[model samples]
Target: MKVVLAYSGGLDTTVLLTWLQEKYNAEVICYCSNVGQEEELDGLEEKALKHGAVKCYVDDVQDEFAAEYIYPMMQANAIYEGTYLLGTSIARPLIAKRMIDIANAEGAEAICHGATGKGNDQVRFELTAYALKPDIKVIAPWRMPEDFPFEGRMDMVKYLEERGVPTTVSAAKPYSMDRNMLHISFEGGILEDPWNEPDEDMWCMTKPLSQAADEAEYVEISFEKGIPVAVNGEKLGAAALLKKLNALGCEHAVGRIDIVENRFTGMKDRGVYETPGGTILQAAHRALESICMDREVMHLRDSFIPKYAELVYNGFWFAPEREMLQAAIVQSQETVTGDVRVKLYKGGVHVCGRKSPYSLYSPELVSFDEAGGYDQSDATGFIKLNALRLRVLATMKKES
Candidate 1:
């Protein structure tokens, strides 16, 4: 048997590599999609081979992740339950799609992932696998036997040690993390209790709130049809621009979220995510849309944002509704061209100013100063027309 595994150079996959090769007598081809984990992907191929992979493919996929996946969610103002921007949720499908592509090219029969059955990731990873290739076989070792989980990190480390595989993980830490270009997520370990406060040391992407600068940091972002084009007047491509924004936004302690959400698989899980660049981009995009988008178009798209976000979060990227909604969202971005100046202060990305060539904001009409298009007196008749139902209700109350 030959199996393709989505291998992160982490405790799970490091052990999973040897296990699959030995148990199924399988030829393992490990695949790692670089979505900006920022870790040393160096020697990952060597490690995979040492653990029994026939070959390992390390692909640079950060640009595709940002352009094809992240930007679409940004365009739609996709916020799941009004908080999460669906960062991790949105990236999973793209990664899985690539895994399938690699699987086909390698002529591998079965695909495997390290996602446990208890989490949303299992659903996200498996759904996309099946969606793309209906007959794709999934190897989920977490549900295999009573001795699985390797009894947590320590046991996994011991198992690897006993098997002569080297690992960097130690028993000292009390957390599990998933990192990518879009966001870094933390869960499990000490985070199981909702009341427990996260340790200050646990965060990697953002500074501590107290350490953030006292004074506000101003940033100007340029948008072309709803996509971020530049930062502070300097042009950058998708990934480069986002990474720059991430640095600046993280300095201000922006985009840290703690939410215990209902998973798509009918379970509740606590997910803490840090999405600094995404925060700035989402805010800036929305600000531009205010002026550049038509009122009716904005309203219609706004109505679908929640559903679109939910669909993405629930692992429905290939679903017809999600695809249909994405088409509409992209259509809405047609006129969202402009620039927005934002002030970042201690975890806040505030829209200080916004301008667009297509701005619907009419200063001349809205001005309360002498020359104006809006008549304050005109509101009286409008109010009277609007109050007819209230007047009828009042008359009925008096009569009764």
Candidate 2:
């Protein structure tokens, strides 16, 4: 049998690669998607080849990831459970899509992933695979604990030592981390206890609040049709722009979130995420929309944010309903073209100014000092008309 596996050069996947080869005697083809994991991708292909894979494919999909996946979700202002920016959630579908493509190209009979049975990733990876290729066979080794007998990280460590397969990760490592362009997420081990605050040393992306600069820095972000085009008047591509903002936000100790969230697999998971750039983008985009978007259209779009976020969080990026919501989201962003000035300070992003060519804000009509366009007497009739229902309800209560 032939199988294509999503290979990350981690202990779990290292063991999984060898196990899949030994158990099924399958020709394993390893794939590593480079979605801006930085140094994590270093020596990945070489490591996979050392672990008995016939061939290893490492593809750089960071630009596609940001422009196609991240940007669309940002347009919807999708926030899962009012907090999470869907950093890790948004990357899964792109990885799965590439995996399915490789499966077809290799004529592989099955596709495998290292997502544990208890986590949401298992559902996300499988859903995207099946949605793309309905008949495709998915091999989730974590679901079958009996066949893949490893009690914990130590067990895998012992197994690798027994086979003389070298691994860089030490068993003493305190946490499991997932990193990409959008964000870096830390979970498991020490983070399992919800009450425990993540140690400051564990943070890799942003600075500690105490270390942030005391002086506030202002940045102007320009968006065209809800997509960020420039930062501080410098035009950059999606990936480049995000990297630039990540640096700026990291210095300011922004976009650090620690929360215990309900996972799709019926468990509460605690995760700490650093999404410096994404945080800035979300704030800037919303500020731009305030000046550009119509009130009713903005509200309607806002109502779909939870549903849109749920789809992304649950790994339904390819689902029809998500696409339907995306259509409305895109339409809502048609007028979301503008620039927003933001003030960045210790762990905060403040929108100080915004301007758009399509702005509906009429300063003259809103000026209280001048009554620029209006008569004060007009408000009396308007107020009375709106108050009629309240007056009737109050009269009924008085009579009773």
Candidate 3:
């Protein structure tokens, strides 16, 4: 048999790379998708080749990920469980889709991933694969009930050493990390305890809140129809703009979240995320939308946000409802063009200023000293008319 595997050049994937070849007597083709992980990806092909992959295909889909996946979620404000931005969740389908395409291109009979049965990724990867190609075979070795044994991380490590495969992580500090342009997610190992504060040394992207400068830094972000267009009046493409903001926000220790979230597989999991640029962008976008979006329509759209967030978190990026909800979300953003200035200091974001061509804020009407409408007497009748229901309820209570 010939197989295509989603290989990350990590310990689990490296072990699986050799295991799949041995078990099925198969030719393995590796596929890697880069969704803004800034680490060196140059040596991945060589690593896969060393572990017996027949061929490796690597694609830098960061732009597509940001434009197609991240932006749509951002427009919807799809925060899963009211916190997570679905950083790791949103990237899976794109990777799985490309893996399927490569499988077809290479004439591979089966596609495999290294996601364990205990995690949400297995569902995300398999669901997308099956939805995209119903006839395609999935090889989930982790879910196998048969005799082959490797119960723990240490077991896997020993197995890799026995085979002479290069492994980076060991038993001592065994946290698994996944990174993309949106954020970096930390899981497993010592992070198992929900009460434990993540060590400051573990954070790779953002500065510590304490180490960050005491003075606040202000940034102005511009949005066009809910999509961030420019920063500080500088025009940049989608990828460049986000990268620029990530740099600035990381310097200020802007986005650091440590939460214990319920996984799709019916267990609570701890994930620490650092989403510097996304934090600033989400906050600024919200301040802009406050004036731009209509009251009731925005309320109705907000109701579906949790469900939309769940779909992205659970890995249904290509599902029809996500597309449908996204259509409504994009429609709500029709008038969502504006500029917002935010102050970042230590770990907090403060909205310092906001403006737009379509702003509903009227200085003349709102100014305490203006008295522009000259309607002091009109409020008496308006107040009485609005109070009619309350008066009746009060009279009924008094009589009773």
Candidate 4:
């Protein structure tokens, strides 16, 4: 059988490449999606070829990922479980979609992934694949009931080492990491203990809070229809703009979070994430929305944040409901154009000032100098009308 594997050049995938040939006698075509993970891809093709891949395809989707996937999520302000930016969750669908495209192009009979059965990615990859192509076969070795050789990370490491394949992970430091343009996540291994704090050395993006820059730095971010368009008055493409902000965020040691979150698979998982650019973008986006979005409209859209985030986290990116939410989110952003100035200091991102051509904040009407309509007396009647229900409740209580 011929199959296409979603290859990451990681421990699991590298071991799986040879395992598929030996176990199922399958011809494996390796495909890696480049979403700005910052890994060295220079020798990836050669590495795959050396490991018995019939063909290896590396597609760069950074710009597309930033624009189509990341931007839309930012527009909705989607955050899973009130904290996670869904960095790993959000990137999976895009990767899975491209993997299907490769499967179709190569005329492969089955598609495989390195995601373990216990993780959320297994759901994300298979859901996207089944949604896109309902009849496509999926090969998940980790999910097999029996006859799978690898029992643990050590086994996989030994398998590769015995075969003369170089691996990045070792028994000395066994942890799981996933990265993309938006953020990097660290989990598993020593992080399994809820009370154990992550070592500072494990951090790949931001510095320690105490070691952050002493001086505060201000950045001006401009948005057009809720999408970040420029930084410091300099226009940049979607990927370039995010990269620029990531650099600035790194300098200030911004966007670091550690939390225990409920997974869709009925388990609590502890995750540590460093989302430098995403954190700044979220703050700036919300700041601009404060001035540009209508109060009622903003409140109504805000109500969708949790649901939208849950959908993304649960691997429903291609579902009709998510698309419906995206439609409403895009509509609400029609007038969300503005500029926001944010301060980065000691791992904190604070929006200090915001302005927009369509700002609803009427300074004159809110002034104490009796400017713009002189409506002080009107508030008394409005207040009394609003308080009528409370007065009746109080009267009933007093009589009782």
Q: Which candidate is the best by TM-score?
A: 2
* Estimated TM-score for each candidate: 0.94, 0.97, 0.92, 0.96
The C-alpha RMSD in Å for every predicted model, in order, reads: 1.9, 1.4, 2.3, 1.6
Note the Cα lDDT for every prediction shown.
Answer: 0.88, 0.93, 0.88, 0.91
Superposition error at 354 for model 1 (Å): 0.6
Lowest summed lDDT window (length 10), candidate 1: 145-154
Clashes per candidate (backbone, < 3 Å): 0, 0, 0, 0
* lDDT tens per residue, model 1, 45-127: 98888778999999898988888889878999999888888878987998889889988998888998888778888888888
Candidate of highest lDDT: 2
* Cα displacement (Å) at residue 346, model 1: 1.8
Candidate 3 local lDDT, 1-400, one digit each (tens): 8899998887778878888977998899999998899878898999899889999988999888888888878999889888898889989999999999998898888999878889999999988998888899999888874723778768878988888886888455658888999999999888998878888899977999878878889899999999999999997778788888888888899888999999999999999999989988899998998877888978998898999999988888788988899899999999999899999888788999999887776787778898877677898999999999999999999999
Model 4, position 240, has a per-residue lDDT of 96
Give me the runs in candidate 1 sitting further than 4 Å from their true place: 146-149, 375-381
RMSD of 4: 1.6
Model 4, 1-400: lDDT tens digits are 8889988787888988988898889999999989999998888888888889999999999999999999999999999988999999999999999888988888888899878778899999999999999989999988884857677779888888898888788455656788999999999999999899999788888887777899999999999999999999999999999999999999899999999999999899999999999999999999999988999999999999999999999999999999999999999999999899999999999889999998998888888876687667788999999999999999999999
Candidate 3: residue 286 lDDT (0-100):
88
Scanning candidate 2 in windows of ten residues, the lowest lDDT window is: 167-176
